[model samples]
Target: MKDDKKTDKPLKRQETEKTQQLAEHTADSTGELMNTNHGVRINDDQNSLKAGERGSSLLEDFILREKITHFDHERIPERVVHARGSGAHGVFKAYKSMSGVTRAHFLSDESLETPVFVRFSTVAGSRGSTDLARDVRGFAVKFYTQEGNFDLVGNNMPVFFIQDAIKFPDLVHAVKPEPDNEMPQAASAHDTFWDFISLMPESAHMIMWLMSDRAIPRSYRMMEGFGVHTFRFVNAEGVSNFVKFHWKPLLGVHSVAWDEAQNISGKDPDYHRRDLWDAIESGNFPEWELGVQIVPEEDEFKFDFDLLDSTKIIPEELVPVQRIGKLTLNRNPDNFFAETEQSAFHIGHVVPGIDFTNDPLLQGRLFSYTDTQLIRLGGPNFQEIPINRPIVPVHNNQRDGYMRQTINRGKSSYNPNSLGNGYPLQAKASEGGFTSYPERIDAKKIRARSRSFFDHFSQAQLFYNSQSDPERNHMIDAFSFELGKVQSVEVRQRMLGILSLVDKGLAAAVAFALRIPVPQDPELPVNHSIPADGNLADYDPFTVDTALKASAALSMANTVKDTIKTRKIAFLAADGVDEKSLTTVKAALEGAGAIVEIISPRLNFILSEGDEQIPVNHSLLTAASVFYDAVYVPGGTNSVATIEAEADAVHFLNEAFKHCKAIAADLGAAQVLEATYFSKKIPSEFSDQTVLREGIVVGEDPKKLADQLILAISQHRFWEREKPRKVPA
Candidate 1:
């Protein structure tokens, strides 16, 4: 619950701290005299001290020795997961005061625009791996709130592959490149992954999300993000509620085809990284509304799924998300290594109003994060690294450790001391000090999981049942493609058995792709994950029937499609191009906020029929249609003939068509389209409905053609055309 009104407090610190911090780091470095680490300036930096001009160097050359030593040890250990990442500087502003639900200053005050640093990453990849890998994206945000730092560390997918954190290592080891050969770099198509998934029934729900188009997002700006664990929001009145966090992209949830994702990996491994950087540079800042789903503490066990299970979701149908704030990433990082790479996030980093739940996975992460940072950052003082530091001053009685940046004077490093007059005093809960909720716990200690976390397939079934036909087909193809890469026949069959438990038709589709029959009893290895002490006959995975058969929010097909903002559209034109048609359509698309890039036979520029020099964004040799949202060909006698004759140009259109993107051509340029394979397969009649379904726009008037193409682009893709009009590139 929020107050829906502004707070009385002023926001001077929240609004200006971001710029002040950036200035503190960068402004001091400007015009600084070159000096060594000891603040000694050396004039002879070019050469080391030597006995003579051509003699051997002496050990007394401190400048050269220091420079070389520093360069050799500059690198720190990378993160174990989410190693490949892109970060940006942003701000988050609450839409209204949420004082009714929480006392966290940032959320309770609507006037404050809190500074935040966000990092988006790929989970299974290394620092040098491609950004287009089909893996979960880490969507972590660090809010420099007035009280302290709050890191909303989460992922693009709402559910996880395991219910407990103990199985986290196993999951990662299976998905990572195999230890022996390490043949695959950043993929999960190998046997180890399927073998692990086949045994862990809890993985079924997350596997469905991984196999869907959600794995290959169109851009970092177009994907949805979710906090995968349930948390507690405690109000000042001593009331609590179970809360889930969400980040809904203003650009809407959209994704690339699996085929297109593979092509992008080859064409540009840093596609997402580049997209985020270029958008911020071009002033098209990426935006997402911060959303949350809150269920009263009394209603926690009212749902079929357990609230404490990380693998389960509180389907939006049960508790609708309330968009509470807006997050806008308007600035790119100043330095990649110092700002983006060194930044640290932790799930345990929270203010007073927020607290943890008994979620097993979450409880484990609270310990793992600090330990991981200590090893990776070289010290416990990693928070002093500016990027990870909060806006408010940090005061503590703890003494220095490795790489300690703070200098303390006076005795009394311990609390309750008469000397130093009891400095650095602690605050009470009434005075904004952090405190955990006092929930009574009287249960006995046990190493067993609750039976409530056993019903794993209902939500998985709910997810599969919610997908549209095109999305379902894509998932089927994804499973077939990935399982086909798995070498072990037994692993494939075991996975198929698990799939059958979710849905028969799904298993049949993938089994047919692998040229195998579906298993009669799909629950063959259901007890494979049981512990050694557990009885095989007693192992049972509860199956709870979901009251809801499907949820519209689970499918990307029902996402927002009213705008084509920031959509990249390619214009395939060459010498003697029709200036009127090309310029008119480009203006129209650009006016509607779409990015129009001209791709011709060669780079730099092209000649129009009116002898006007038209600039080209890229050449066909360098530009691939997979990098664009749509493709268009304008009419001109010479231009059309040249384009049709050029094999690469024709291939561009064909590949775009194959990827299910919108395509268009002027009526006079119809021959250019005919040169492609699918031109004859689609409807010849140019009815608006027929044209819309096929994602092909053809009209004599430039304005009319532009309008039709805009509509097609807004639809994101014509996925239905993919199955019937499969074309060659």
Candidate 2:
């Protein structure tokens, strides 16, 4: 494989010595509790100041008063967008030095480990919202490099909802619940969102993504991240190149079904967060390959659309992403409020060798992110916050804001002061000072977008066409459902106009459900033009290029398989179970990395024939089948009889069957499988061993069945087999 992680240089131990020292002195590096902000080291924090017999509070207790006062005001404002988020600590390592491409030190070396903090969030939800909402996910990374901190504040989706930054507020307002009711707090399945989406032609591409399974990801570990807009990289030689950043999950892109996501929200509200924490705690660190698509400065305008457009992507098929470095998130936040909450990421915090582009939305984000932090963090000195502070030494002259921590020893607080021999002066370009790529501009400022951005349908068409058969069907169903909820006939019809521009067939299908006739094709400025140097049709999904077929890379079906590393499996058993068989099966599954939980009639231990007692983790009433990935039933005649008499036990099996999950059973336990839908044998043996048809594996010899069950569990779901069950897509 090519060494693709060459975009930025890494931080060496010697170069980061000062930063490491500063970090060690700060409260962030150590978890020990010492003095309060007031420098008081008085111990006992368990109880508050009280009167005789703890009947009344005392007024003379300064410690208790200060503690309560600070605690009461601890929470800062959550982000207006991306309020609900989860963050992790990681290190970024470049595959090799990328000096050939850029002068960014972090990407230019292989020996350095750049410390990183990454926060993943949903765009539309508030701080307490559910994780599985149908919305864009923010994938922002803050790298504490040798020179300074660099923030890649971006989204999971490569393309955005709109072309310009000015319309962001409008887009946000429209997508939020209707002003009158505020009915749907964090869902896109509401009227206001559909209304805005229906009218905005530019939102067509993103709509397909939001409507698709990508919106409700299975877990943050399995989703891809994109910088969203093109950025410029300038070397010391003054040569410039346009780059788009990508973070490809090593687990492969995966998402949960809409039904599963909905139920997971109710059953486990912190599903995504728990998944991440559990994975890290179990030592299964999440990893992503850092990749970048580079375009030489001269080839910037050779594409069909403007490189500055935020609502577009240079498909991997066109200019393939060169995997460069790797990012591994191994640690969870020690303190959610101090680390995850106070960590501020801004696109403007670029160090030398990396620069910006004219992408308007990016330009606006550069300002908005840092500006919002000022108010949310309570001061211009927000950078002083431990989580937000860079590892690099900050020597700016500005000082004295709210929560300021540093005590300046020198008399001079200005750069050009004779009082202290003019210390902290600006460094020249040779001393690693940042210099923007010089692209001579001589054009009049205009509110209008370039004509190159006009044809929104081509890329949407390309994406839709690029999907696999099942993926395409899911997209179609999602569009139908979202549009089906639109209360306005006009809104539904207008959206059909935009859809028609992408594919007439797709428009007609959605229109059929909305009871609206597809409107005449939307007007276009350049007759669906492709750039002279570019070929949009070359990558069309409708051709023999199909042999390269469903870019196995694009399908969630092709993700990491046969590894039950973090999969949850419920072992449904009761008293008088076959101890040897049960122990053997449980050990085998657990040894394969599956988390096994015993589900019995009661939480007490269930004793076997030889007096071997198996402690149950959950009872039938407490744990539901939906909470697990697969099911197992150990042989026990009385246990089978007991389970049959219980409604919840039967219901658990029924629900798991309806969801098309795998169920492994032996001779005695096979009676339970025969009692459910799986009693009817599947007509044909599936070539794909992972298919979960009826999910009932029977017979005395269960090793084959266990092997089959493991494979089925890895499939995530028998989505194709779902049609007969009448489960909604």
Each model's backbone clash number: 0, 14
Candidate 1 local lDDT, 384-422, one digit each (tens): 888988877788887788889779888988888889899
Write candidate 2's Cα lDDT for 409-488 as tens digits.
Answer: 78999868999888887777767777777778999975555666665666677777767666776777888887777777
Candidate 1 global TM-score: 0.96
- Stretches off by above 4 angstroms in model 1 are 1-12, 27-33, 42-54, 523-525, 684-692
Which residue pairs show collisions in model 1?
A: none
